[model samples]
Target chain A: MASKPPVTPAFSLAIDAMGGDAAPEVVLDGLELAAERHPEGRFLLLGDEARVGAALARRKRAARICSVRHAPDTIPGDMKPTAALRIRGSSMRLAIDAVAAGEAAGVVSAGNTGALMALAKIVLKTLPELDRPALAAIGPSARGDVVMLDLGANVQCDARNLVEFAVMGDAFARAVLGLTTPSIGLLNVGSEELKGDDRVRAAAETLRDSHLGANFRGFIEGHDITAGTVDVVVTDGFTGNVALKTGEGALKLMRDLLRQVFTSSVPARLGYLLARPALDRLREWMDPRRYNGAILIGLRGVVVKSHGGTDALGFAHAVDVAMDMVTHGFNESIRDGMAKLATQSRALPV
Target chain B: MASKPPVTPAFSLAIDAMGGDAAPEVVLDGLELAAERHPEGRFLLLGDEARVGAALARRKRAARICSVRHAPDTIPGDMKPTAALRIRGSSMRLAIDAVAAGEAAGVVSAGNTGALMALAKIVLKTLPELDRPALAAIGPSARGDVVMLDLGANVQCDARNLVEFAVMGDAFARAVLGLTTPSIGLLNVGSEELKGDDRVRAAAETLRDSHLGANFRGFIEGHDITAGTVDVVVTDGFTGNVALKTGEGALKLMRDLLRQVFTSSVPARLGYLLARPALDRLREWMDPRRYNGAILIGLRGVVVKSHGGTDALGFAHAVDVAMDMVTHGFNESIRDGMAKLATQSRALPV
Candidate 1:
């Protein structure tokens, strides 16, 4: 088992209160829930003072643990990542800045994903020896939760970039999912070694010969993602993004089809009521809110991006991920893993 | 509506009778079903004479319409495409050769995808002005069926390749799905034109300015596949293959979860009985057999590859697709579309 990091009470997380669809209200509600879940956790809430102050008025318990800072502007959902970088007074930027300034251990936002990635990359920068940061998220699988990475952080990636993603994904599964030594697999069209593009083949070869080869499962197909064939699924951003969305689309289609089936007749409606408890359990198990957070890994500090359309519960889950990262010292583990990889790559007879 | 090709009785489809998991038996059963569906359709069955003759004896109806040929060899599923290319007496190769020799309009096989592609490419070759063939399949969607390609035909595709895929996918959707001016969307990480890699962006630009621009729907995310946001989704083989398999995985996962939900308690069990009819309908709607065939588009002749593990019903659906392609003159439509694209591309300012 990987050694657990020391529990630290000094870690605080920054929240972009005016980020998601519901904005300050959803953020405050989520903060209250998170605060209740983790009594020792502290929060720095950045947003319009009046709006945040009004929302906080109802959550005295959460307000006691959160310190609010006034930010005059907001980053629009449609704003490009480059344009978002110039908005200094925006709540999203200010919240991320808190982490960069060491006022907080991590940052959580439900803002535009591209903007969040850009601002976090600029503010916290990447870890030493890492060329780019990857967005990692946990997805529900048949056996358990699966960690997948590079979910649109870098559109096009090379062999070395994929290797880096594998390392970061491995550390992430260990840190957040509490896996001891997670099996990692490079996502490809087929499990066969000769089935994919040149970049994938080279990355697979590197992983096979690396020190982490014992835990590396080689190439895994798309079905393997939900089959829980591997603990960590690493791929380039474009493919990862598409796979993630495609899975989401399939689940949505299933839900819609089920709804249609149950509402088709009176007997089906009765069955729905009778099976309500079991169906509810199934729904909760597959709830998007339960798997809400997507972390920008390889960053100097932890940054979590929640789905912009998600509600309070989803935002709270994002906070849980951020807290887990900060408490577990995710970045430290990644640094150690990278150092080991660097040595292993150099030790190879060139 | 797109003009339907004149239905000609001269169209006969060739079957690789020694392919699939339950070869000869499943092939005969599927042929029986297809013969009943298309009373006027003729079939050329190619396989080992003894085995195929034995299966054909029990399938009198299919045997009446099929003319059996003695192909002594069978291509093993694990054989490489290149190795399979040299086996001239193999059932798979013979079935494809029948199309080249003008004995059949198209060929259908539930065999090794790689070998089928390679053999078909060698025998039937590619259509004029088309560099490579692509695998195109129809997937169930919220609005109906959506045509997507290339499902592992080319691992790495350039901007020109993507544009070609868009053209082929557009034609396939129109021919098989019976859509007039089917809207086309290039699969990407984001819906924005500037969001994806150079190839995707370049393809989008070409599609936007070409003769097919009016029917082009711009970039679509993975979720858009099942959402039925567009009629045709064009992508590189690697991405398309991953997306297709990911979707299949998600559907299987949903089915497993539903089974657990419906059998958890006595009430749920009773609910299952009450909802059986509706659930059955839902199952029929999403049945794999209903959308079995995946056509290798851009080839000189139509070639359909069924899932190797699928049963007789699935194989029948594959034959159904081949029959549709032949009767609808799918290749002719593709040739016309490519000619139009070539003319438009030449007229553009370099």
Candidate 2:
């Protein structure tokens, strides 16, 4: 009865149905739209069953498209993700667990980041000796798209963690960006070896000694984020968070400034109308929705993260990102690749 | 036949002859412009006899214009400021020493920051028992300018240091922004009381209990910097430097992006041409030249710190800022008013 799925294996996504600032409606809208596009893709919707079911029933999506799984509680954004992992009933934990247990191919959430990270770590666990999992965002760059990581996974990290991050980041880039070997850069205060704090200097030394160091392209500064000079930008959570927020704030400020300038006078407003098409094209390129979702890397299974304030369109893009990772065998590839490194090099610190 | 300086007892400003990337060219240009505007103002040029003398010889200004002092050595930018301070022949140190000895009303430098701070601190010393001086910049806000301190003075600061910064920032806003009792805000990871690290949270409590507590505006986040939500944003040197750099990088990125969009197509270029006047006005308003220099506060003598990369226009504006502070007696006013607080405050940890 239903048309064949866009792809064969029928990607299964575990959605945190109650997550995000405008959940349920937007989540349902995103799900219905994606279901319509893929027809055969299976989905496991995790949240309060009654409400999720009610929302889905109104959508008129295919009956076999999605199944409901109850997760009675939700993770509050303020709680530290590490602490929230211990609480059993959290929706984020249940969603990630579904993917880890093979009940679903991927997990998607727009919940409290700390809680999602904690849950993913506990349920899926780190790959081999990876001490910490990192959060990565795939955003628009001057070179089309680039990955930035450790956005806020762990606040403080040593050189070993950075070395591992470079490895994981490279693996993710291979899976997502499709680069054979992604060029990785360690983010610091400046490009010079003498720049940044103690952690950065030590990280640079460790990176220079590793086999992974071949693909590691020197240090990059805060301004280098959107510059598109490298495939991946690596930094500890604190600096990364500050940089991320600063970028977000800048985009918004520029948009406001542009709008004010466009509408300042009658002639300018007429010019805006005449140039609306080109401006809109430019806006689409810079829109957050086009690149909102990020993947929580260094986990046992695929887990995509949508921003807390994402709308239906953004959520739909996150679903597509998860589907892509599943089809690409992202997790298995990382595990197999890292395993070879572990056997060949005992020099890499745990 | 030099005319007598207008009858301002506590106010005068000495210009550095060998400061900034462009050196005497930009500095002298600024001096000439300011001299024309304030015909009764006085300036002392500090540098080598040949250069300063030659530059002065070229200027045919009002009689109250200039004086010159010779120095045997110059401090290059790459060397550490402290090391440069140890050299007695360095022009920057000599100019700062003039201010300390009350031979000049103020000293302004666009030279190496670390060097100027070191020389100023050593020669002028802190007000009484105050251990370290803070560099303060006036961040432009919608309501007015926010007094932000320790732009890069102290890197590692404690809870007590932040509290003192808030107090000093409040006093600064009162004197500069012309608020009788200005609002103070602590820069934090979030607006909540429990949001920041141990130091920030503890400092918030201390701020609440201090005499400056009545007008304290609580915690403000990074986005608040451009949002103009607070009259004062106080933080230690590390975070402040990060914020300042982020803003600078973001501003540059936006300008570049606008240029790219405008030149992408003929239609867009035409639109940009039509909107040029309004956009140009906005650019002028946001220009760094208009907000040229920072005052190194809490020292016994007034010192203005200019940006290292400043051009002729920026240099000119720095001169204007220096003139304003000198004429307004900024140092003596704050020192005499906060003498009690300065004496009672605990000395900085060495």
- Model-by-model DockQ, in order: 0.82, 0.32
Candidate 2 scores an iRMS of 2.4
Which lDDT tens digits does candidate 1 get at residues B1-350?
01234344344788999999889899899999998998888998899998898889888789789888999899999999999999999999999888877778889999888899988887888876677889989999999999999989899898888888888888788778889889999999988767899889888888888878999999999999999999999999999999999999999999999999999999999999999999999999999988998899887677999988888899989998888888887878877877888777443212
What TM-score does chain A reach in every model?
0.94, 0.87
- Report the Cα interface RMSD of each model, rounded to 1 decimal: 0.6, 2.4
Q: Best-fitting candidate, measured by TM-score?
A: 1
* Position B250, candidate 2: lDDT: 61
In candidate 2, stretches whose alpha carbon ends up further than 4 angstroms from where it belongs are: A1-11, A32-41, A48-65, A70-93, A112-128, A141-146, A156-165, A215-219, A324-350, B1-11, B36-40, B57-63, B79-87, B121-131, B141-144, B323-350
Model 2 alpha-carbon miss at residue B228, Å: 1.6
lDDT (CA) for every model shown? 0.88, 0.73
The weakest ten consecutive residues by lDDT in model 2 chain A span A1-10
The candidate that achieves the highest DockQ relative to the unseen native structure: 1
lDDT per residue, candidate 2, A155-185, as tens digits? 5567777767777787788777788878889
